[model samples]
Target chain A: MKIKKVVELLNAKVVSGHDHLEAEVEFCFASDLMSDVLTVETENLLLLTGLANLQTIRTSEMSDISKIIFVRKKNATEEMIRLAAENEMILIECDYSMFKTSGILFSAGLKPVY
Target chain B: MMHFEFHVEGGNFLKAGAASSQLKKILKQLNVDPKTIKRVVVAMYEAEVNIVAHAYKGDIYIDIDTKKIEITLIDEGPGIPDIDLAMKQGFSTASSVVREMGFGAGMGLPNIKNNSDELTITSEVNKGTTVKFATYLNQ
Candidate 1:
């Protein structure tokens, strides 16, 4: 699915990488632990995480994940956003909890990284 | 072939992934495959994070070539008493602050092992730990 569709489906706010709204992502991994994020070995993946920190962006960059949607209203700080922008990663914020966000995205045909 | 070195200060979460980021950029410039680059970056990032989260300070030495990338991280800190226990997932000695950042899940070493082609870890209690990992570029 295109990231723009995800933003609309979740009523998410694009906090960074507005240019990447058209990017396509096939898989989603929801985890607060950066370690779990690293374990996922998929391409074109979107990370749905409740952890809003610099490490989140760093982990995504290392794992080749270009899109991240912060769940449960966990807003990415300015530093985090700056890093995402530097990495050309898209960051989205949603008010839904991680579980709900996962369910919504999964039902919409996004595969899990299991 | 290229060589890079970096010094990492423990507990400095802000600069934790700097080395990994730089390495990824270099790998991309060298035209490494995306999958191989991801594997190398993930393994190196996990090792780097271990140093920042557990050690007092550390040094990272990286050697990159067309065939493979090798990284060695040596840190001075309270080393692991049992390497086996530390390698187990969900076992962590990270502080509460580190846990709050969504780290210290005890998955760092395992993630490194899973991503790297070869991994070695040695430590002495109260002394330090040295982790050596390598990932093949063609795989």
Candidate 2:
């Protein structure tokens, strides 16, 4: 699904990387654990995480994950936004919990990384 | 051949992956294969986080060449007493603060082992630890 559609489906706010809205993503991984996030090796992936910190951005950078949705209304700090922007990652913030966000995206045709 | 050194301040969450990030950039500029670069970065980042989440101070030594990349991380802090136990997935000695930061689920070393072609660890309790790993570029 295109990230723009995901934004509309989850009512998510784009925190950074607006230029990537049109990007198509096939896989989504939801986790609060940055360690688990690093173990994933999928392309065109989206990360739905509640952990809003610099490490989250760092994890995404290492994993080559380009899109992130901060679930449970978690707000990305200024440092995180700056880092994500530098990594060219698209950061999204949503009020829904991780589970809910994952369900919505999965229902909307986002495949899991498993 | 190229060698680089980076210092890691223990318990400094914000700067945890700086060294790994820099290495990744250098590998990219060197036109290393993407898969090889990912393995190197993931292994290095996990090891880097281990230092930040547990050690008092650490240093990362990196050597890159046409055949492979070798990394050695030495830290001055409480060393692991049980290497076998520490290698278990989900075994962690990190504080609650580190756990809250989405780490400390005990996967760092295992992840490094999974990504590296060669791995070795040595430590002395209450003193320090050393982790060395290598990733072959041609793999």
Candidate 3:
């Protein structure tokens, strides 16, 4: 799925990298654990999580994850958003719970990178 | 061979990941294969976090070779009382502050082991700990 498709499907607010909406996503990894993200993830995979911190952004950076969907209405910190922008990643904020978002996106053809 | 060193300061949450971040940069500059680089970064990052989260202090020494990459993490801290249990995914001794920083999920060592080709750990109670990790260079 294209990243923009996820944005539209979730009705999420794009926090950064509005220009990369057309980027392709081969997989989506839903996790609140940075270890799992660092170990199992691949580039271009969308990360869905409720944990909002600079480490979330840092984890995305290390894994070259270009798209992040913040679930459960959790907001990313200002530093997190700024880092995401610097890292050229698309950050999204959504009100959907992680389980629901995963279901919605999974039903929309998103699969875990694991 | 390329050599690198990183200091792990105890109780410094903000600098916990500095070592792994720098190692990633170094690997990128050397044009190491992305797969190999990720192995090194993830493993080393786990070491860095362990130091800050559990130990008094640590120093990571790296030896990058064409055949293999080696990393050694030495720390003076409260040693692991049970190595077997600590290696489990859900085991953690991290404080709340570390958890608030998005880590301490108790997956660091397992992640390190999963990413590296070889790993060895040694610790002494009331003394310190050392972890050695190695990954083969792709032929």
The top-ranked prediction according to lDDT is 2
Which CAPRI tier for candidate 3? Answer: medium
User: What lDDT does each candidate get?
Assistant: 0.91, 0.93, 0.85
* Ranking 1 against 3 by lDDT, winner: 1
lDDT of 2: 0.93
DockQ of each: 0.85, 0.88, 0.54
Model 1 Cα RMSD, 1 decimal: 1.2
* A27 Cα displacement, candidate 3 (Å): 1.2
TM-score of 1: 0.96
Tell me the spans in candidate 3 whose CA falls farther than 4 Å from its real position: A41-43
Sorted on lDDT, best first, the list reads 2, 1, 3
Residue-by-residue lDDT tens digits, candidate 2, A1-114: 899999999988998999999999999998999989988888878999989888999988999898999999899999998998889989999999888888898889999989
TM-score of 3: 0.91
Q: Put down candidate 1 lDDT per residue, A1-114, tens digits, no spaces.
A: 899999999999999999999988898888998878888888888999999999999999998888999999999999999999898999999999998899999999999877
- Cα DockQ of the candidate 3 complex: 0.54
